[model samples]
Target: MAAIHLPRTIRIGGGVLDELPEVLAAAGLSRPLIVTDAWMQSSGLLARVEALLGGAGIAARAFTGVVPDPTVTSIDAGCAVLAEGEHDCVIGLGGGSPIDSAKMIAVRRDRTIPELKAPHQEDSPGLPIIAIPTTAGTGSEATRFTVITDAETDEKMLCAGLAYLPLIALVDYELTLSKPPRLTADTGIDSLVHAVEAYVSKRANPFADSMALSAMRLIWPNLPRACADPQDRSARAALMLGALQAGIAFSNSSVALVHGMSRPIGAHFHVSHGLSNAMLMPAITQWSAPAALPRYAQCARAMGLADDSEADQSAVGALVEALHRINADLAVPSPRAYGIERERWEALIPLMAQQALGSGSPANNPRLAEAGEIEALYRQVWH
Candidate 1:
């Protein structure tokens, strides 16, 4: 049997933020907790959101301390605010961190103890959540997964369940207009990896495959343009939509090697999720391609690197080269170049590989890799 899940309502366009009141009304939520980050608070985006909600006579409380790679402590803190305010809904109004934090907060709101916050343990229905993504990465707005760091163990907990999916998603491309070039590139590449991994996953289904292919086609051509010129609304729009589509695809089908490997790096080294994904993407793809040639070739064609006459292997090569070119154009720095010491990175390889395996994402890959293969891939990225 095939199971596909998505949000009930998705509002997208240039000024979709204006529709939040009506969305909340339809959902019967009048008081909401606005979860965001300090950056968004400082930039007045949170205020803008509050004003819009206030204009519609909706009451909201703001909790704006979510950090990148949201930790369990952070979720608990936000949940405290939610409990105190007696919020009926949650508006996640930033990038991945805040959106992810919001999901967890909603899930854990009824829990009086912290021990019950583990994945699949909290069985209560979460409050209604409306995700507003300011960045076109992570697609947390559309996904059912919420990654949070375990404060005690310093391990990233991949908490996932249908209850975590947002009730509504508001994707407005204008919110991403201020993203710098490097962010555009990193997040755009992250979205691309999500789509490709979803397509090549052992769990890939007909529905996810369609969404993944469509996301890749939309993102590949427009990411560079968006990176080169952040003011290009059309390019930003395509990238935003592509990221959300890829999120929905992977949320149902699962993310494979790259994400499995990427999460540990973020947990241990404090690297951004997208950047860590960027670091391992090329190497992981190269390693996994042979096991899923037809899917890789399909991805190549979607990226416009394949012709009917070209061999599948040749097209895969072209695809890899094209990715390298995009990395160069975007100035994606290698892990070594990004300044992690050789000895330290080498020391953590075994542990990172173990954590990656424990995350269960690699099991979903078309080519399920053992710990040794993951370690080898990590070594390959060091150089």
Candidate 2:
């Protein structure tokens, strides 16, 4: 039997962010430590949230030390802040990095970072997390996963289980309305990869399949629109909802090769998680589609890139081409083009492959690859 998990409460819409006090009261939580990035603080959103809480007679402290591709060091820093407060819950109030930092911070209990890595599931709950996602990507709000990089080793640790999942998600499309075009494109593509990878994952079940298909339908069309015009409320709303669905989808079914391989790129190259995923998508899709033609074709049809009349083979081909075209249209750069020195990239291929294998995500692919094959894929993606 397939297992399923989700947040206890999810509030979605425009201006739902204003109901944070009510949500806190409903959960019987008074004090919260808001986990966010420097941008959120500088943009004055942190102050606005604090004011809202203060107006409701609740004083909240915020930790704004989160960074992109959150590291073990950052998590420790946030946890140190968590220790200084009587905070009963955590408010994750930014993109994936802050939310992930919040999740890791809540669960850390003097345990070493290596102890939490994949193959060791952390099912026990930690401090309640109230996720207020400011972007339409990563789906960290709806997920049971957190990715943190080991700064020294350059390994992106994939930590799993129920503890990483949020207790509540406040999905406000309004929060994403002001996102710039590049961030919009990268995160949008990241959500699409979540749906695609989950749909084809070996762990996929009926429940996850439903969510993945629905996410593809919403995301595939709206992504471009949202990227082209950030002010398009409908597109932004659709993308936000689509990202949540994709998060739920992958959370249940898991992500495969694209995610496994992409993490290493993020760790070594310092690329944003979503942008790294975008760079790897086209090549990986072309590589993996052959082993799951019918499944890939279904994804194509769901994304409106193909129709029922088309054969699976042709549909899969169309899907690969569309992925490449989307990357081109979105201006996603190859690792080489993104300016990773060729010698450094070649030198790390073996270690990156080893790290990718250790992540355990590649095993979920329909067609698994050995270290050598993964090394080759890394080579193929350089240009």
Candidate 3:
């Protein structure tokens, strides 16, 4: 049996943010809590959204405190805002942090204690959520996963369930026009990893495979152009659409080795999620390639590195080389180069390996890694 799920409504284009009021009204939501970050708030994007909502006669309250790598404390704060405002819906209006924070807010709205938030816990439909993504990475707008930090432990909690998927997703490429080159590159690579991991996951089905392949084709070619010129609307649009598709693919299927290994680095070292993924991507792919040759070959073809006539192993090798090239071209740095202390990184290897295993993601990989193997891969990336 094959199961594929996606958001009920997705609006995409250059100016689709204008459809917010109509979209919300059609869904029977009136009052909305706008979840965003201080940067977007300071940049006036939040106010612009408010103005657009006001013009369409929808009332909204803004909570602009979500930080990067959203912590449980941040979610708690946003939920407080939602409660006081008595919002009927939530509008997540920034990148992954705000969107992930908003998802948790929706889940925690009725809960009294914040610590009780778990992936498996059920919440009464608190409020409908509309995810409006400003960046093309993380794909939190389309996925059911929301990574929240345990502030006390400094560990990332990868909570996921059906409830986290947005009721609607509004993807406007225009919003990403101002994204700097580093962010564009990192996030674009993150999207690529999502598609690649989904395609090679044990849970992958025919439906997700199609989406994953299409997403790779869309993202691989346009990422460099978008990075070089942030104002390239067409490239930006392609990347955004690719990211959305990759989110749906991974949401229904799963993300394998790269994501499983990437989270702990983010939690322990405070590295950005996409950059961590990029740092570990080449090594992880090389490690897992022997297990899923045909699928990796398809990925190579999608990235335009090979064709049907090429040997599967050769094509997979090409894919890995291409990823390394992308990393070098985009200036993706190694952990050592990114400034993690060598001794400290080695000390945490065992704990990070255990945490990665505990997340239940490595088991979904086409070739599952034992603790020792996962530890070795971490060491391999040290340089």
- Please, what is the TM-score per model? 0.96, 0.99, 0.97
Cα TM-score of candidate 1: 0.96
User: Residues 1-383, candidate 1, lDDT per residue (tens digit)?
Assistant: 56988889999888998899999999998999999999899988999999998899877899997998898788888988887887888889988989989988887745533344333544346888889999898888888888888766667878777778999999999999989988898889999999999999998999999989999999999998998889999999999999999999999898988998898888888888888888888778878899999899999998788977788999899888887777778877788988889898999999989988887889988888999989989999985
Enumerate residue pairs that collide in model 1. Answer: none
Sorted on TM-score, best first, the list reads 2, 3, 1
Candidate 2's residue-wise lDDT over 1-73, tens digit each?
Answer: 6999999999999999999999999999999999999999999899999999999999999899999999998
lDDT of 3 at 367: 90
Q: Which stretches of candidate 1 lie over 4 Å from their true place?
A: 110-124
What Cα-based lDDT does every candidate model obtain? Answer: 0.87, 0.93, 0.89
Encode model 3's per-residue lDDT on 1-383: one tens digit a residue: 78666778999999999999999989998999999999998888999999999998877899999999998777878887877877788889998999988888887745533344333544345567799999998888999888888867666778777778899999999999989999999899999999999999999998888889999999999999999999998999999999999998998899988888898899999999999999999999998989989999999999999998999999998999998999999999999999999999999999899878877789889998999999999999998
Which candidate, 1 or 2, would have the higher TM-score against the true structure? 2
Cα RMSDs, all models: 1.7, 0.8, 1.5
Candidate 3 Cα outliers beyond 4 Å, as residue runs: 110-124
Candidate 2 error regions (>4 Å): none
Best by lDDT: 2
- Quote the positional error of residue 169 for candidate 1 in Å: 0.4
